[model samples]
Target chain A: MKIILKNICKSYNGRKVIDNLSYEFTPDKPVVIEGGSGIGKTTLLRIIMGLEKPDSGEVVFEGVSHEAVRFAPVFQNTRLIDKLDAPANVRLAAREISGDAVRAALIALIPKEELGKKVRDLSGGTQRRVEIVRAVLAPSDVIIMDEPLTGLDEGNARRAVAYIKENMEGRILITSSHSDLFEAFCETLLLK
Target chain B: MQTLSLSAALCRVTTSITWADSLKNGTARKILIIVFWLLLWQGASALVHNSILLAGPYESLLALCSLAVTSKFWLSILFTFLKITLGFVLGLITGILCACLSYRFKLFREFITPPISVIKSIPVASFVIIVIIWAGASSLATVISALVVFPMIYHNMLSGLEATGSSLIEMGRLFRFRFIDKARYIYFPQVLSHLHSAVLISSGMAFKSGIAAEVIGRPLQSIGNGLYLSKISLATADLFAWTFCAVILAYLFEKAVSLILKRLSAA
Candidate 1:
């Protein structure tokens, strides 16, 4: 599938974060958006994910319809429900996937002991991993991540990226990060 | 082998933490405090000496025992209990529904806010009289209870729904979660956390207002009627006995509602 962003513009309080930004995304080619803080990397991702409307212009998917594109997002922050356990958090988004499959996927990334603990009780890195597990386990045509590896140590970040690459075959992976590690696997989209 | 020991250790730690929390505010201490208050009341009543002015604890207890064996007492208690509970449940449901509607529509929220504010400020006695005039005596308690409880629950619901983290809501939206899933996994917990305190405050208010309405309206075969008759006959012991029953009923209802809400949130 080919997804195109055409002249997309977004501004907040008279400051333009996204100024006529355009990009093309393909299923086989992973896109990594790199920018400093407040340069609208997350905002651009939100525009693509349809969580926010661009001030002008459009997001067009040539080969695929809008409804056909299911997004599994690892938000910039670990947005897991604090009241729910790690496995339950994953299972919430992965509704179409079998419970056993989701549980197995979560148990693989997170420790067996931690799966039953509330996400709020987990450490920052552990919680980030759980969010990754949620995204990976979800049934999605596009995996949208905004700074997906923000809280993780170098080793865990590498492992998380590996899990993403291994599990996300045939799925469009659009991730934004300040880290250069994603540059190895993903085509770069730099924003000023 | 290592995992087993770690799991056991976690269990022991959590158990100890729970034990500590309970000990800090234990039920035994609560009972002792209640006993102390009752003893003070008993002493005060004995010093008064006049039964018309103050009934001793023993006299009140005897009056309660006599009422217990009588069908009239049970009937009146059941009548008032059912009416107030019905009103409470109705108020709870309506408040939640209104809150959700208001949350979704800004215009509706604006439209409803002023009236709800007025309801909140209005005196309970005024509501009881107004409701008695509008709906008559039998439905006065139900109407008054519902009126008393609605604004409180509605206010709490609004704050609870508002308190739901925007970040989690964004996650739900991006995931395209079904309405039921969003409600279950996100909204329910957020709303319920605030709901715990709201239920505690409103349940007590509901009982107090409901009984007050009944007492004024003189609902047939109700606790309020019993209290009225005791006052007229100068039966101080019976008045105290009936008041005790009202307090016990209100206390039990609050406990049951709070317990149910806690269990639901846990589930």
Candidate 2:
């Protein structure tokens, strides 16, 4: 699968955040976009995910409809339903992913006891890990993660990155992060 | 007054100061407060010396006991209970549906605004009178209860739906969640908190307006009918008894509904 961005321009308050940005993203090579703060890394990811339409130009996908490529996002915030427990939160994405699969993905990172508890009750790092597990286990063609390793320690961050790399093999992975740990696992695309 | 310990302060903020707790601690402060109020009432009743004008608490209690023994009294309770509860449940369902519609569609919300505003501002008596004229006394309580409850639930439910975070909604979109899944996982959980509060406030209003409508319309076999009869016959004790029963019933119903909602939210 290939997604091409053509002269995409986006502005907030008359300041151009994305200035005629163009890129070709293929599923074979995972891309890690590295940039400083306010360089529109998140915004560019949003544009790619088809969440924010650019002020000008468009995105074209070859060999797939936009809907056909199921995109699972690990939002900057762990957007897990606070009302649902960890296992339930993962199961919400698709029926194809079983409770056992979700539990297995989370078991190394999260304690078995915490897996049954609501996401709100989990610590910040645990919640982030839960979000990572949710995105990884979901049946999807593309994975877009916005600072998915924000709350984890180095060891845990490495573990989470390793887990994602192992689980999401041969899929289009797009992530925006400053972490050398995350970039080490995927092909890096620096954004200035 | 000593300064409270940290745990004591936490407990005070988290839980109500119940009479049972006070009694367990041998304080008896709450019991004393109640006794003081009863004495005040007794004194006032004696000073008035006219039972027709002011029945004492003792008289009210005696009247309550007598009414409790009668099958007609129980039937009157049941009759009003069914009508008011049915109306409230119907209002709750309609209010949720209308809130969803209004939240989803701008035009429908604008169209319903004037009616909701008018209903909110109109007096219960005016509605009761109109309902009686239009639908007759038989269903007065039902219509009146629903009318009083509609605006409250609609307003609260709309606010609840509005309170749902846009970020969570975006997440739902990304995940390709079905409408039911979005509602169940994202919307319902947030809205249930608001609905719990709406239930607490509106349940009391439903009972009050439903009974007021019954009194005006004189629905046969209702608690309102008994109160109306008491007023005409100058049966002060019976009037006090009926009023007390209304208060108790309203309190109990609110408690039951709140309990159910709390348990549901917990699960």
Candidate 3:
């Protein structure tokens, strides 16, 4: 389903954060919202995720959208439940996806043996990989990732970009510093 | 490479020596510390020349060893343990329930705040006497202990729930997660950290306060009554032995609770 944000404007404490921003997320291409720090990248993502309502404008999603839509965030901090293992962490959504599916998805991204290890036990790169696997495996229509590759070496970054590029089948709205994320076959929605 | 290997091996051995595994480990160190303390206690007892004033460890152990064979002793210990443990369990459940209610409804939390504060500030002796007159001495220890434990746990859980990560909640909202998922992932983990510490303190407080209640209540064949008898008869050795039992029980309960917590976290 396509999501349309028309002239969305939001201000916190009388200072405009996301000012008259209009964007659309279709299945054809990934949308990247490129801006400096505190430039409302997160605020804009929060609005799309139904976390915050825009001061003006409306966010319309395709087909049977709830009055208040739910979302999953690919936050910079990973926002992992440290006590739970990777498989447990991935299936922490509403539907309770099959354990086998969770295990399989985690195995596909990282090693299966590490699936039982708590998120806190995993190294930084491994944790990020687990988070990526979690985001990819979740059954969400729109995945809103904010600076998904903030902490990674070149090799892991390439691997993460490759995993996202290869596995992300539906509409994805991501904010990134690496321009190479857009060097792909799919169309790009550049949100200024 | 050869010199580096030797240095690396030395570093490994040195780094492996953690304080937890070193300071209190092995019979040599433990025995040495025990002997030093025992000698000091014995010297003090000898100088006092009064068994009622201070009894040596050996004398206390002798009293404890003799007490262990009696059926009444076993029954008293069992009842005492059961009462305190029940109070601890009740406090834990009540605290969690109250915290959940308070978090959900501001009105409920406001209503509960005064009671919790009143309970916290009330003198232990005052409660013990009040509980004794109200409920009698038979189960006074447990009730008092539970009262002390409830506030710490209830406050900790409420704060813990309030401190849940906004990002995770936002994530849950984004994905349209059910209430159960939001609680299990976002709330439960956040609360468990503080809850674990609160439980330990609560358990200890419950044990101590409950025993104090028993001492005041003077219930039949109870550890509390035994303690009272020790004071009346000036049996300092028996007093120390019973005090040792109480301390050991508290320590063991903490260990058992911590172990269960560890296993739960691992799962």
Interface RMSD of each: 1.4, 0.9, 2.2
Better of 1 and 3 by DockQ: 1
Worst 10 residues of 3 chain A by lDDT: A182-191
Task: Tell me the DockQ of each model, to 2 decimals.
Answer: 0.54, 0.67, 0.46
Docking class of 1: medium
Clashing pairs in 3: A70-B173, A70-B174, A71-B173, A71-B174, A71-B175, B141-B210
How many clashes would you count in candidate 3? 6
Residue-wise C-alpha lDDT for candidate 1, range B133-182, written one tens digit per residue = 78789988788888888988998998999999888888897777889989
- lDDT of model 3 at residue A49? 70
Q: What's the TM for model 1?
A: 0.86
After TM-score superposition, what is the CA distance of residue A48 in candidate 2 from its true location, in Å? 1.9
What are the per-residue Cα lDDT tens digits for candidate 3 across A25-62? Answer: 77666767666677777788777777679999998887
lDDT assessment of candidate 3: 0.79
| Candidate 3, B-chain TM | 0.88
Which of 2 and 3 is ahead in DockQ? 2
Q: Rate the local accuracy (lDDT) of all candidates.
A: 0.88, 0.87, 0.79
Give the docking tier of candidate 2: medium
* Winner on TM-score (1 vs 3): 1
- Between prediction 1 and prediction 2, which has the larger TM-score? 2
